[model samples]
Target: MSDFRSQLQEKLGLSSVDYHSNLSKEALFQEALTYDKGRIREGGPDDEHKAYQTRLGVQGPLVFYTDPSCTGRPVKDTFAAAWPEFEDKIWWKPDFQKYDPEAYLGLRKRVVEHLNAKNARLYVQEVYCGVDPEYAIPVRFVGEYASHALFTHNMFPKDVEGVRDEDEKRWTILNVPSFHCEPERDGSKSERAVILDFKDKVVLICGRADYCGVNKKSMFTVFNYLLPEQQELSMHCSANVGKQNDCAILFGLSGTGKTTLSADPNRRLIGDDEHAWTKDGVFNLEDGCYAKLIDLNKEAEPVIAAALSMPGTLIENVPALPGKPLEETDPQDLDLTDRSITENTRFSYPLSANPNVMPGARGPHPQTIVLLTADAFGVLPPVSILTRREVMYHFVSGFTSKLAGTEVGITEPVAAFSACFGAPFMAHFPSVYAKLLAEKMEAHHTRCILLNTGWSGGPYGTGKRISIKHTRALLDAALRGDFDEGNVEYEKHPIFGLLMPKSCEGVPSEILNPRNTWEDKDAYDRQALKLKEMFHENFAKKGFGAFGIEDVMA
Candidate 1:
């Protein structure tokens, strides 16, 4: 342990610095409770400047807030310092721009100097990113906030072995929420920036990127690039194992019930959010779950709700229950409906919080691959059995929807197509991930399906979101291989040319085909056709069809 500590300090150039490295969760929790302005529940510091005060009698189940203006990810202020040594390997879009390595050097040097000047006590947590010994990489997290260290400790695996050359391959995260950037001086668009430097294997979190997601995702983005180099698939999905040890993987973007549906009481959870599919099997890149908590119904999601009382769990941004102070109220009574802080409220908890979880956060090759989508247009069938080619097509054209009021100007349902269901994090081209997925599917002989948990009768506001009971039933039937045999009747979707089952046990026959549920036949036809064209347009825009992926629907 001492040798590893020395290596970490030397690797991060922190030998002379007074920093705590690889402390226990309990120690970090105490540090955060005192140093990070941790509230008793939601009671913030009176002065805000007294953040450094060590308040005794620290009651836990603590809550913390980011900058009020930037409660969510600062997407605009994110950039990559792609070194000239490796050019064009990373996808450099406008939102994720390329930073000048020279500018980053000056900014980082000054930032470290500033931390030293303030005598800020840094927290370091060294951990692994994945559970699989072959694919997982060691990550040394050096940050200003103790909560970030605890977050990293909660979200990733520790004591992972067989990752050769841990020193050279490991990545470092230099997170300093205290240091705000000057746009002109720091070459940042705003006072804060989240910069990823591939050359140094470091992520710079200047400003209050106290959003715990930045801590987890900064490493995931790197894994997406590194894993594919070894022909492995890094996925943005949720996975779980069943009673008979049957494994299922659910793929989708935000608003899709990947996390919610995977934490089944009957099944054992493997992981939520990030995973890697390798030659051996599938393993969760993260050992913990970072689930959204906006309007969370405790009874409906018992697994997640039950995790609230666990010791290592951390809740972000959810306000205190109405009419009571946090010090007096139970954290489970948190006002999930209150979006006063931000709608993107979250909960970070380790897998131990879940009573039923796959050991080591590892599972076999998935028997069923579910492509989940929340189609706000209500045009997609509840469940569509996909052919192998269709799976390849839809995998790249990863489609979902944005309901009205989700963003600033989206007054109606808007079509959203993310390449591989995760464009921003996919460092390599979409084709890279698509090809790897194809290889895995062929080797494993996996069956794929598209399940819509969005709307039924009509579009959002007019129709209801699909019932969770029905969604779970459909998913259970899929995992059981009910559709594998041709016993259940299926009808061909006219507009999108998908194979929709006519009926299933526990699901209504009328709602199986989305058209029958709608009041107006002509309106349903128009909407379905519009959604079909949107898929084609997305395919063309992404140029996925040219990357050896056929336009199956077209």
Candidate 2:
């Protein structure tokens, strides 16, 4: 054990500790079920149990339940300690609260004291974040709960073959959810705080939020900060490989169809979220997929549906049927629509959950790069082919709507533009990643497509969400060169300037033009221009003048 480990052990006052360097799936499941951290719905005996035992049946599948109170990340309560070294590097947004070093140390002492008072045994799990040996980061997860450790096991890559035990670059996350902090003294906005110390490479997650995502993403924020130094472009995207080894990456913010679209049964899934495009190829930063489960239709999303029943998966904040005990609850009995717990209801399952997964979670150079946006304003075309410059423009713009109920107070879709599709996780300026993407796309001759999986015809209330079937059809067309087949005509979108295919084979020709489907052409024009203006304003604020970023003004 290092000095850091010794300090933690002494602070926690543990008589003995269970250090799982890398616990096996079965072992993790056993621990999760044993300590009351999570309840495993077992099979056999009764009808409910019987239903749980079966594979992907109507009753869904058995799941391990986590605490309802912490279904989603506490974004508001999180903070990043402003040490001298990386203070200037941070984006300093509302989400990234600045914590004074003195205050952070004071809070850490209090949190440690509280943990020592609990006298509880802690589970220390060792894991790796990246799949590529050269860029992979070793991580240590220390938590009071076993289920979180299980989550750590399921969500991160475990093959740390070349990483040495003495690797000093490992990030140590201390998750003590029971330790509440004083807002005034801790320099925290709330009682719960997730603080990242860049200089120390340590994360302190204390108080009310126990969502496992906090731990995982804390390291991701670090990666988003560090990877760029190595000239690697880290992205908030999903990736996959086709039969011909042709790779594709889907970039989108939360509530967009990045997860849904990338899980095509025909293609081998490389990863569901968080990836890096290096000189070699695309590599998944995470070993697992964290997917939203609201209104999940097994038939429509067979790949994601299949993962629900996988043994090692961890379901967060999904409610069970009224009278069903967690131990006997069938996944089908659980209400996917229930937001009583949270709309951010999610599950984390390993890449192995998808049968058709790329081994080593890596793929060749991307042949297609997709920008997925749920345009709630419903003015953008369903699909449009983009020039290389257009791709970079949209890439930096990262326009997507904030879906209803995804956040604590948001009850309806709201237009949002997160730079590079994931502003929160990004640690550097958007230009850094944009420049890298542009270089790689040009070098690989990759085709880029803008996919709108949001509303069509009108704005949110008046319009309807584009059918997944249609979106998939459009994606298939782009991937298979169907868009380029025969005599293809392009019409420029008046406001956004994207070239829409005049007609696609499977898609209805009339709807190809968004204006045609709108009941009021004038209203469509107004909404379209409004959204375009929002895009211009966002790009202007980014100040990418040096990168030649321009607004698509008519």
Candidate 3:
């Protein structure tokens, strides 16, 4: 205990009395069991007894609450007596628990060090829940040397404090609310999350969720904790605001060239994952970029390669041989099944990677809002400028592919319309972000454009994927305002929503429609109907039946 106290005091930069008086070491471990029990109850208390009996029959109730506040509870008493079940659930596998405690403590120390360096206040709290309807956990702590309580919650204390009220602070916070549920064998749980940002005395809640199914609950919670606040001018998908005058907002889902396209050397990067566009200008949500580090080819993404080689960048799940050179290893040959290494790679870079970017990673109101889509079906044109109404329509449409290996069967091209391109992460509802975006764009006089970076000549399996280089060229031309200068005529198609001509010079026109691209018109029609039907089914599952393909099919 003395050693622990010394360590805590040293890491927190607090006197021994300060450390002991507020959230002592004894409290942290003593609170752990109660916290675990609360998690079990909140996760699925109804199944608690049944699961307990199935795993360990007649061994009292299968759940328990160690918090003194939860005394006299039937479920808690029963589970407390059935200590074996609690032990079984709480114990991490030996291998899983084999991580170096020193390393873990080092991480905590590093976080404290960073916060202290910034002169930020710190608050620590412990939360515990019971398996009941009235499960309310109260977390309390003192704001040592805090100038103002910047953020607060019942379950956690102030996240960032001790900063001046008028310091031009830019930070984001996310809150995931507790929903009704109980414990599981795998130790997974659900919660509702929201992202908030506080800047210039205004609060913006970016995403919210209401009963969006159990699979997405954890994702929402994680999303909230990742950002500073829900209102902190952040969007769910990848976004990069150019630093130059007349800069535009680049938006795209996971794989649609959002990071690759936006990390242009000529344009400054505000952020790669999330950002907020206000009347004043655009504000970056993060200090780094969470880039997808899959199949990374230096020739394709040189800046990203350089970023990976730099410091302050955290690489998750990438295979690197100890004492071996990084150049000799081919990222593509790494194991694809390891998500930590293959799929979920993040790259953090300073906002000043590009010189033309706005200083302090801020930008004026977007001159253009470019929505990127990876149309696996090679039929859509490379680019199409849209009116405000059209932008709103497409914003709600939110079309994109499911990426390779995400779904079985139909691994080929398919149409998926998720509202705001982030239906799953939204906290309040589907139209919340879309409506806000429409309002913001209108107020800022921003135009909307859609760019397709997928197959252009045929269906997914048969057609050659569009050349990334050509897509880059087209994007560069658009950013330079070249297309707006040219008097190009758009041809409406029967199945696709819009089509731009090949005579536009930089873009190939043959991909204007699927029917024209495919050799067999019958096959094209069949594929089109199949995709349309799939869209209809997906929308139906979400209780949205108003959207119909025939209405847009020219």
Candidate 4:
């Protein structure tokens, strides 16, 4: 404790500011109830002394709302310092821009000065980003609000052993919701900015954007940058293992069924999001799950729904039931259908809350790799097998429809392509991850397939949603090797160049080939051609061929 202040002063210029270190969840709950700001009218009676009861025993759920301007990730406001040292290493996505190195240095100092002058009470939490001791990075989070600290506690690993030099190489997150940035002076796009200073190993969340995802995804960007250098593949995907010890990985962006499908009653979950594929196998980067809470069906996604009642869970941006006071209403009673708040409403809970999980948050080499896409256009086949190059092609393409109600201002499903399915968080070039994926798939002799869990006969409004019953049937058949070459006959997708099965045992054969189900084959061809054009255009713009991935459509 004696040198703790000096250490902060050395790295962060943080001193004379009182801070608590590694506080437990119980203590943090008390601190949030007392000190955290941005509480809404629905917030329970503003009393910190009372011990509330939850289903897990005794802790009231913590609900928080961010600034109306920052209900979702202020993607445009995010930046990375273009220091000459490592600027070339970053991919610099369309949404994640570069900040001047000189201006970034000045802005960071101003934030520390603001924290000291106000004598703001701070909380520090020490945790690791990944589960593997050999590569997990140690992270130190220093923030004014205990709620953010508790979020740090929920979303990352703690007490990890065998990490190479755990304390020496630290990534510090400077979270200050109170310090506003001046665009002209601080070189920020807005009053709030999430800046990553790779050279100094620092992440600054300045001003009023306190979205909890900012804390998680910022570190995810760091992991994506660091892991690839060691030859590990960092992914935005979900994984689970079946009874025969067969492990499968599903890659997709949010709302594309990665979480929903991977939580199969027949399989044990490895992790829901953010993982690393290394020489040994795959391991989870986070110790918790931050799942979407909008329109969540209790029967379909019982694991996440049941987690709402657990102690120490944080529900963000979900509004209370209509005409009911939040304090008196049970957590379950909060309206899930109401997009009155942001559709990105989320729930943060420790993995311990889940009943079925991989023993060590790690699994063996995947036997099956599934690329999930919600094709609102309804032109793609329901299931198609992929070769190694096809996997690389689609992996880099990362196409899915950005569903309406999932983001602020987005009123309908629009074609969305995020490289590696999460371009914003990928620090290096898309090929860095794609090349590594190809290597891993080859080394393990893995089977790859693309599955579309979107509309069937027509586009979203015109066609019916593909039945989950059928999607599950196809998924189960693939896992059991029913689609192997000898098991089922295959036909080529003329436009996309994918090998899709002609039939499956449980699924209707008509739906197997998407065009057959449509009333007008010509219309289906046009839509299919339009989607293929999208893939080709995105491919040409990115110039992925330079990275050794060729287009299947070509």
Listed in order, each prediction's TM-score against the native is 0.92, 0.87, 0.57, 0.94
- RMSD value for candidate 1: 3.4
lDDT of 1 by residue, 120-211 (tens): 68888889999987888889888877878888998999999778878788888888877879889988888888888788788898885668
Local accuracy by lDDT, each model: 0.81, 0.76, 0.42, 0.85
Which TM-score value belongs to model 4? 0.94
RMSD, model 4, all Cα superposed? 3.4
- Tens digit of lDDT per residue, candidate 2, span 31-105? 554553322233322112111222333223324443444566777876788888878778777767788988988
Q: Give the top-scoring candidate (TM-score).
A: 4
Error of 1 at 347 (Å): 1.3
Each model's total of backbone clashes: 0, 1, 35, 0
| TM accuracy, model 3 | 0.57
lDDT of model 2 at residue 76?
83
Candidate 3, 192-240: lDDT as tens digits? 1121111111111111121112111222222322322233223554444
lDDT ranking from best candidate downward:
4, 1, 2, 3
